[model samples]
Target: MKQLLILCCLCFLSAATLAQATWIWYPGDYEIWLSNRMQNRRTDRGTFFPVFWKMDSHYPLMDFHKDVTLSEPEQVRIYAEGTYNVKLDGQPFEGTPTVITIPAGKHRINVKVFSQATVPAIYIQGNKIISDSSWLVTYEDKEWIDETGKTSDITATKWLHAGSWNFNDPAILPSAFTLPVKPMAAVKTENGLIDFGKETFGYVKLNGIKGKGKITLYYGESKEEAMSDKGAVNVDWLTFDKAVSQDSTLPASKAFRYVRMVTAGDIHIDNVSMLYEYADVNEPGSFRCSDDELNQIYDVAKYTFHLNTREFFIDGIKRDRWVWSGDAYQSYLMNYYLFFDKGTVLRTIYALRGKDPVTSHINTIMDYTFYWFLGVYDYYMYTGDRTFIKEIYPRMQPLMDYCLGRRDKDGLMEGQVGDWIFIDWADGLSKKGPLSFEQLLFCRSLETMSLCADIAGNQPDAEKYRLLAADLKAKLFRIYWNDQKQALVHSTVNDDVTRYANMFAIFFDYFNAQQKEAVKHTVLLNDSIQHITTPYMRFYELEALCAMHEQSYVLKEIKNYWGGMLRLGATTFWEEYDPHESGPAHYAMYGREFGKSLCHAWGASPIYLLGKYYLGVKPTAPGYATYVVEPALGGLQWMEGTVPTPAGNISLHVSTKEMKITTAGGNGILRFGSSTRPTCTTGTIQQTKDNWYELSLSPGSTYVINYQSVK
Candidate 1:
């Protein structure tokens, strides 16, 4: 009995230690430093390529502190990066102490550190005292000392909750983090040509390489591009002077499935392999349906999204791995449905909004700036992390202030010098004046600011922004709404009717029922309007239809558009897919032979659409505290899937004859339409609409219903 008691106490102590000890740094500093290392890694044909926009660095100095009340005296082990000092209850130690003893009762511990090349971070652990996010951190300067030299003058400074991630082991530093990689071999090998059989991103490995010679590998998403020296967009040129045979691997990672190898002199490689590098994230949500082709599209889209999800959600793995707000906005929605990885979403938001004096719009694009705000709005609704909203509110105000400062006399946003008003990548799209689309986004951002301001406890600013948003929304309709076109015009300067603003207004809830019906016929379904070719915009276009209860029509668009790319042998979705182009012409864009990215993040919107619309699981309240599930078969024989929330997963299985659902948490309503009266296993069913019925759901109960399909 004595031995068992001792073992139990030891296990409890170990668990407590594990729970409390974690490395931490200034909030968002490690994310910025990590992204700096990841973004500068892009290489174009062996020439160094970096982002054109300004990049920010981590704070060189950081102060971390923790105040605790202890019942017994204890000692803590200290670990940190760079030169540091320790303080105990406002008293300085002789030097930085690896182990320090604390007295019983209340006391405070402070660690100050500085490092120019990396973020200053620390880890502390003990039997009872441990470093964790409960600690506070700041980067303010407090060097002004009193005449005594021991006492110091303090200035007003703000401290935030320290930031940390999965770096729990002290042996592994945060700055040394890297994605794990695994070895893979070619599926097919020919004379100087190799194919991995599908699209992949990794470093090339040459096995049994020897002698001194020149070797070059041309990478391609398609077979033809790899064989053409002039057309290949990515290449590896290596010079060797080795006397013995040994395996060699390239330094930089590239995206490719096929590689055409060329060598000069006596270079010889017996075999070829690759090291596939990928982000580690959990896929908590899933989807399946009766249609095999739609299932395949969802699978490929998930792959495409995972490829672009790296240190930050990037545009593509092949080129410009830098985070773009517009691309990441779509990725965040897709991630909520698939991975539900909160770390990636937060990291991408931090990396894009860097530490700002409000320099330029995120990615230097006007529309991208608004998308960042929109992403924040969605992040809160899905996760309901009020702490994150409070932390980011400071950055939000300044960015909004910058936007407000740029407005013209009309209180409207217009393209200014050095501002790129990028709405889409179409050929004839105009950016010449105060765009209706920009105004729409700006108004939405203001509304987001108002919501966040209320959450952050800034009631004055919240009311101010609410009124600002209301005024801009009214101006938007007056300036851009055209009765004849039944759509919002493209711009005030041209007064041209376009689909951009009208389609956005539908899902944004800016249009009335009568206006939405009119615009759907005259602008969305109208053939004369310039057709959308890029999957980026197609994401929203299809979403507009889905929001209007046109999931059946949107399903066909998904088949013809995303399915069209799959029919073209796309292992991963493309940056843009236009069914008009054929052969090598499908790969050409921006005047370069292979400038277009074959695997892009925004191309993966089916994950969001199917999970949210077809499955019809959405949060009517923050964090799924209250949610509604209204499944749409959309002509499918059967469909089933799960949608993730902070609470847990909401799973649903639906078919023509029956419907079933199980929720992890939240008060939910299972809604459906049955031409014949529906019967449920449990719960009271009430007819909510002419053909629709609603069933209240509790968290742990599994509700099954038998119903006949309507429509």
Candidate 2:
């Protein structure tokens, strides 16, 4: 079966190649089939986006050299010979044992050390190096050694969850902890002294207490020695109820966010002094991308997960505490591919897959696999590499089948209690759980799976999924369509919930005439051109709408959505928009919250794909057979960019007269099959009547298009 699947996929790739010079979609092609196939293709994975800043000299730079040491101060001045660029406290300190200042707030610096000499060398771990969200140990700097020993020391210390974002791909179950709660009391003994006492077993609640109070402990016989302030390390005092507490017997420590006290007290006894225990350094190692060049691209998100159920641990190790929330996990999953490797991403996914379905930590296999493929497809898209798909697609088959093949008698995919079966955002209000939108997403996932299956040559499986997808779409309409509202309801049980469900239905092309028109009316508007807008929705929600071709309102919402991400306290994209006042823990979800910073990859997709690609800025579609130049320019000042398409550099230039595109240098031709459809003229560039054009454009020059009505 696996071999057949592999063969089918190979055949599909072979067929696609035979149909066109390359396997990717291009601009000049039949609109319907090309768009459908491209949309159905898996999303790009851990590949870098086309748009990137060229790292300048000012950016922290690192060069590699062989042979070095930092065993001692004297050793630092002598024998410490390698490339410099390790800046400590803003001063360039070469070699090892150099004194450098560490700013108060966490500062991320890039380190580049290489060894080319035949004899190997070692780079000792520096002090207070914060990578991957955790501190790394200081290793002894030794003589020339094996070069493979160089490893990242930074690690993550916390986890977040706001919404759809999951910083770590795949995912794992969340962590849990338990602490002992004690009770307390106050009693005036014998003469005039007040001897306060605490009980380890009894229940005591500190409710409705106004002013501050404290209970001092007395140790030995007489009040002098017994009340001596100086005592043993084991001596400690327990303040009122709090999320954290100090133990004299243990090291000093602080909680990531919150700590709760089950019981409160006015009691203190003997052996007691303030003592804090530090949490052990549980995880080790640092992030994969620590170079200054990529630091701008890397953000707190690289250290934290926005959504999903994975704990932030160094080197894939477990933490002593639960550091993230569910909301952050989802955001991470959708965005983490920007800076990580496939193996790292796969490891993270495997952890999440192993999680219990009951806990929000893992959700279900369907949601995980669906998003996983989205990332995998992205990997293929940006890098134009098929090895990952060829190697990993087989493993993904069973998960895809589980989501599609397993069904209820009612023809519905089974979702857990809090699990989102097939609904988009906002439908969570439906107590019944995942509705039409959710099912639509499932169908979308199946569609992608079927594409993979067909490519893999699993004809029986491909037919099975295709049929299932068709049936699900039909069932989605029957169940959620509202004739009275003239649109699809957010859920079958609610009419007031009528929202952008129809937009997705239209975007997914899952509707009929009346339905499509109803959706077009309520969901989109032609502002300037066919630009889609979502007034009350979040940016990601809008991206799905735009990606799904809710094209009518895309332009107006594009800038606002991207701008909104910046407005939040995000240096890059966030799991969700953080309201004006939000604490570290008070984000959108309980497991992976949104306050996580440093997300750029997926969040930047709409700008490139929607604003740049769809809005006719500078984007191309690699056709299944030929090129189709259909430009839709949203309201961007002007966009000129080149994406690494399978057909070489597909350069698209859009202005206000004629849209011009050139492939490679001018060596490539824009071929449009005879079957190309001709639509009316609109936008800055006049829509051409010809199906194809082969032209040469000067480098750094642009093509223009004049604005026209959409009627």
Best by lDDT: 1
**Residue pairs in clash, model 1:** none
Name the regions of candidate 2 deviating beyond 4 angstroms.
1-366, 373-387, 404-406, 417-428, 431-434, 495-500, 512-514, 523-540, 544-553, 564-570, 578-630, 658-660, 664-711
Expressed as tens digits, the lDDT of each residue in 403-499 for candidate 1 is 9999999999998887988888898898888999999999999999999999988888899999999999999999999887778999988877778
Each prediction's TM-score versus the true structure: 0.96, 0.44
TM-score for candidate 1: 0.96
Backbone clashes counted, model 2: 133
Best candidate per TM-score, number? Answer: 1
Q: What are the runs in model 1 whose C-alpha is more than 4 Å off? A: 1-18, 141-154
Each candidate's number of clashing pairs is 0, 133
**Please, what are the lDDT tens digits per residue for candidate 2 over residues 615-652?**
22222221111233344444333334343333344555
